[model samples]
Target: MMKEQKDNLFILVKSLSKSEKRQFKLYVGRLGVNEDSKFLMLFNILDKLSVYDESVILKKGIVKKQQLSNLKAHLYKQILISLRLNPSHKNIRIQIREQLDFATILYHKGLYKQSLKILDKAKTLAITNEEKNIAYEIVELEKVIESQYITRSLSTRADELIAQAKDLSLQNVLASKLSNLSLELYGLFLKTGYVKNDTEHKRVTQYFYDRLPEYDLHKMGFREKLWLYKAHLWYSFLTLDFIACYKYASKWVALFYENKDMIILNPVFFLKGNHYLLEALFYLRHYKKFKETLFNLEEITKEKWFPLDDNNESLAFLYINNNKFNLHFIEGDFKQGLPLIDNVLKQLEKYKNRIDEHHVMVFYYKIASMYFGAGENEKCIVFLEKIINNKSLQMRADLLSFSRILNLVAHYEAGLDYNLDVLIKSTYKFLIKMEDLYDVQKEFIKFLRGLGDIYPQEVKAAFIELHKKLKQFEHDPYQSRAFLYLDIISWLESKIENKPIDVIIRNKFESQVLKTTFN
Candidate 1:
């Protein structure tokens, strides 16, 4: 019976169009097979994905709209079938029954409410108690969608769906689903502008942190296993448990050696870059002694570990964030970063004009961020303004925040305070709104502090208000919350006193806060 199914799967893959092949790969990914047949099937699936990607590129180049739509439909159906067919792989099956295919499509279409509704149903479709593990994707995706939509001014329905999803997830219908959901929620809270007092943020991280080490991170193959460890790493980070985060992250890094073949099969180098950057950033902000640890990772790889094309440029941003200029840019020689950024920009421009406006917007924002980092301030402002002016409020929220925060500092430094007060006011409103939704609160607060620093007299009242809010947070103390309070208060003090963050503050943060979580 299994042999017949394998043969049929191969045939189905071959008969499908290029788009169908890509969709099939997603489904094929769900089923587990340790034997020769599964391996062969996986190979076939990869071949199909390659073909499909080629076709997509070629079709895209030719500006073939009709053909593209046809290909997309074919691919979409394949995705649906694949998602629907993986019962033996419990997680995949639950995702299917939960209607992830439909939800994903709706999300792409900008119909977040509809997508979330399907995802909500997906949370309840699991059978065995373990099946509940898959619901987290829906829950987290819903939060992302909600944040995206709310930031834009869409109807705020994400909380309702999240509530529904969380209720089911806590019942233990599926372990992996619950774990993944908790992690996803943690990420969403961080991504959105949520405060540490945000109940959802606290609850999700606490639940997952307490349940760490139960996930056998080595069991579920590379991609899946990497994600599991990644979740634990994040949970540890949120709980201000740097030791725990680092321990899991180090274990995950070591797994790269044992399952090197699997590591080579995925584009995890980018992930490693991000992980290292996170460590470096945390250490820099906290343990200044480990600041040199940032330079440890190399610039390029001889190992073609993954099939990422020009996107490596985006990955290099991790290095950039770590301030490891030599690895990516030797003596300011940006030959590598420049070309990569250019390629990504071209892709974004092409997608913007043709494929999808929303995708174009995302790429546009990424390009703008690159430009800002590269000191192309004029170009950054142009793209940033364009995105902020986009009709979508959700879109405008991030774009506005990014543009205003960076440029606001420059303007203040230059003493170009024409209407700076109004800009700061609007910015605070946006950040506060985001904070309420459990969105990017840490970043928003950081920006608020930055504004207070650049124009102390102008933002004094607002800074005091923010300080008051931070003070109230002391009543509700999670590890992450404690860190946030300290960071914010330090920022406030620096702003009030017209001073800079000294080494002592950094040392205390590293020793008393960050190291406690990740070491």
Candidate 2:
């Protein structure tokens, strides 16, 4: 009678909830407290251990295909009946379709919000039916969404989802489910947004950040593991998250540097170089000690070859930024750098894929600046046209800056005969809309400087107004354009009322014009 009564109690516990069911499993499986008390304590304990191990094996992807197939066959039938009764419970269907359909789409598209939304709606629908049987499935899918978001540094939603997933995953004999979810969360964090934001407010939500390394070190065999370090490095660079950036970069470098021979052909090297260059640029901009490291990096990069695609093209952009720094700030033979720029663009173009559209536009922009600097106006105009025509270039602040400068140069060289007014006005409009007032003033200065040579007092007043506006940014690096302004001033001042033009101004103008013929 006692044994039969215990069996009835066990059946009641199993139907209550997942958490209650787990408590029952633990009490029965671990404490040797079976309904059938006929067994010796040790025998009951051993049986419980066997059941625990069986649960572990089932959870760890170790179950036989036939066994899972049989289990799934029965479970699906129950799930279908539950769904039929509570068809409105999207959470039920989402849970069942997670790994199979609905959740997979969310994962593929990086849409975590939609995944959880579907699961929550389904859960609400399932509440009406006690036998929904979707409790386990919903729990697992919810965990995946939560873990994935947490790993990606989508901290805004992570904490809430994690709390909910953890509660559900830990319910009942869901230890195996919890363990799998934990591993996945750890792995996805490593694989995606490994680094959190640089700002203080953003880091507060990450509860599991500290536990990740412990988890990662244990599951190092996972292929996507390497990407965790890479993602962290990229995130650091993106958010300017320096301390974490350096920490992860050192870890990543150490990982590959020792086994450099093994992964020399791997895509990670390009990723590493990208990391190094970006970090170097950050340190080079903000700190001083990294210069020597930056110098040695150039040598390491020389030994490496890049394929002509997006990754290699990123290296090309790094080269462009570094070269611009060298040209404008370092005070070297800027012309000597042109060959290297040309070589990179040629390599990118060799791929013949449109993936390099932005890179190519950048190349054209740089070349235009270089030619304009050399007074090769016609050549500058050709490259400027390339930049203006590329449809892929996003009209961001940087692109707007480049566009305005190029347009000013193009219009000045094209002269009034070419209806250059249209180009100049369009450039002014773009800069004004972007709130790039400083560039707009520079364009105006260039325009007045170009025309001030021909029309004296009226254009001279325009130049004076531009100089007044420009004076505000006197320490600005772009004030270097003042050199041209000075030249224009000198030329205008040197002109006598009756003189044809100063011989010196004529000579300077002719020399500038001559360079354009073959450039």
Candidate 3:
């Protein structure tokens, strides 16, 4: 009685598309002896089951209890082999690895000349695609073959191999260091969010510069430059420098465009670079560039050449839709963005296995913000509650903190203020516990906490005062990151102006557009 989620064989079987399952069946029956095989029967049973029940599997009598594990393992391996042989999955990396495999087999069969020939071709393909690590492997294999098979050209070939290996090793080390630094910065951002104070800012700045590897830009290849830009992008994000983020993200995306073939070989990195660029633009409030970038990305992804495998498909959905939400926020057209909410939720479910919980919560938060902008306070509260109540979300303390703060605002707006005091206290406690209670959040909580004491006639003046107080931090280096999460200035303007939040935002957007157009 194993659960479906815990059973890898069941999950794999369930993950297969219709064509894949068909291929698996054909693969099993290719010899005309495996049609009624126990593994095939087990695969069929698992494929048809909605829940993985060991008892039901045993009752089917495909195999005895003691033999079931081995059969399941064999079935899993066979299904994977079939998938590997699928034409759709045969990308450049796979093709190169297949060549390497063929070369290795030939070398083991005492066919050194043929092995060297294949390795030479693979090494060229790998180097051209910036697959330096695999290219290094090919060179090592060639070195072994050359040393054992004495030939007239062995001296020059050995020197060439040694030089190539040295160059590739240096590039690989540089890329690895930069990628490691980028990942570490990203992890830090997820765990605790942007630098909260001067102390934190200095710490992050020091950490970034200390670990950043030294490399000559002119001598660097596409892969090294890509990782270099990625490292800088993450550092900029953690430091809340939107301008720097945009600069590096632009460089990252440009690198791909300059080497178009690399885009096909490294679609994931290409997608991420564009996504980060869009994010930086969104934060900088560069409306025109953001729209253009989003449009370009959407068009590229729609192209037939763009990889649409499950992983890339999920990422495209996540990045594109996440930015679509931002686009509505930018335009203050939350009502129009409402349609995207249902579509995104459905896709989220479809790609649930590929999308992580952190990203799902991010989508939820964006949806909640959209509802808030549209003045659907109750619906906003409903979505915010999802993030606030999620106990397992260990990342993005910033998101969780703001979710609670936004929840309080939505609850107050929805006239659920009977428990306002309780909600405010709990939110305050939560922020304090996360050590994320900055000036913006503190001022917000204090204003909400004092709302009960203000007379109805004085509420407008209170709103004005709060707006004035919070406006100072709108440009503050350390505190402005809070505004990125929740646009409190616009919300307060909506209150003071006695208009809908979306109206305030729309007016602001129009002014910015006109300013950009004129300037």
Candidate 4:
């Protein structure tokens, strides 16, 4: 009895769209004998099943128990082949590979001239699309063919092939190194979050610069430069350098704009670059620029040629909607943003299999934040509980820590203080366990802990005192990240001023806009 998650074939069958399943059936039916084959029967059984029960599969009489594994594997491969033939799945990379496959077949059949011609066109297309690895493969194939089927210009052709291969190989190596460094930094950011103090900062700085490969910018192509910018962006993020993040993210997005055609060829990277740019702007509180960037991204997605594949669609939904929430947060219009929660949640459910748990939790946190700002403390607590109670969400320790802290605040605001002491203790302990107890969090917890002891008449004074204390770290490199997660200062101001949290935040936003406008 294989676990549902571990059953690859079952998962694949379940993931298929109706059109895709129809195509698969038609693909198998093309071979009249395969219409009733054991593998086809297995596919049908897996497709109809809501759960991957090996015993149920055996009872279906598709194949013998001992032979089931082989049959499942065959079905998986055939389904993939069908998908590969689907027109929507045939992007430039796949097209290039298809050409390479055709060339390889021809080369093996002694059609050397024909093979060389196909390889030449494929190498050009690959290079144009910045698929350097495949371009190198095409060049290597051409060289092999040239050695066996010599022409009058063999000497010059050999030199040209060798040069192209060398350049492509170098570019691929550089891209690989940069991509590896970027992935490592991203993993570190996820595992422990941003560097907490100067010691962690120095360690991460050293780790980043040590692995960052040297390359001449002028000589680098789109693929190499894309990875280079990504590495820098991750490094800036880990070091809590918002300006640097903006710089690298801007460069990343600009690279695509400079080469507009590459946007279609590398839509995922384009979407990610824009997302990071928006994130950096959000952190910087650059409202004008953030709005402009978000608008531009939304418009880009609406363009005629933009990809609408499932993966791209899921990411577009994730990044665009996530930032739309951020936009509302920056403007302090949480009430207006509340309507978006239902749609976002619906999309999250629709793409649950595509989006990861970490992002889903982030969405929950944003929803909770919106509710909190809108003065809907009970609603806020409900969403925060989703994140706080997620025991298996191991990534984004920072998010988990803030979710608990926000949960405590929501409870206090809603006057659910009967269990406040117990909640405070658990949250403090959890923060300590996560090693995420920054000064801001400590101050917050300390204030909440003493709330029960304060007289009702002195509560406003307590709020003012707590506001003064937390305001000092509003710009602190390490501690300020906590404020980005939960805007305690505004919450305190709302309490002291006897106003709603949204009113306080909206006033602050208006003042900042005025200041920016005057400046």
lDDT tens string, model 3, 1-519? 843355888878878899999888877778475567888888889988987789899999889999999998998999999999888889989999999999999999999989989999999999999999999999999888999888758779789989999999999999999999999999999988989888998999999999999999999999999999999999999988999999999999999999999888899999999999999999999999999999999999999988878889899999999999999999999899999999999999788778999999999999999999998999999999998888876869889999999999999889999999999999999888888898999999999999999999999999999999999998899888888889999999888889999999999999999999999
The whole-model C-alpha lDDT of candidate 3 against the native structure comes to: 0.92
Collision count of model 1: 31
Stretches off by above 4 angstroms in model 1 are: 1-179, 190-195, 198-201, 206-225, 237-244, 269-300, 304-387, 390-403, 435-519
Which one wins on TM-score? Answer: 3
Against the true structure, candidate 1 reaches a TM-score of: 0.43
Return the clash pairs for model 4, or none. Answer: none
Task: Please provide TM-scores, in order, for all candidate models, with all chains considered together.
Answer: 0.43, 0.39, 0.97, 0.95
| Distance from true location, Cα of 252 in model 4, Å | 1.2
Q: Global lDDT for candidate 1?
A: 0.50
Model 4, 1-519: lDDT tens digits are 843455878777878889999998888887675567888888878888887889999887768988988988889999999999888789999999999999999999999999999998998899989988999999999989999998748999899889888888889999999999999999999998988999999999999999999999999999999999999999999999999999999999999999999888888999999999999999999999999999999999989899868888899999999999999999999999989999999999888778999999899999999999988999999988888877776868888888999999999999999999999999999898878899999988999999899999999999899889998998888999998999998888888888998999999999999999999
RMSD of each: 17.9, 24.0, 1.8, 2.2
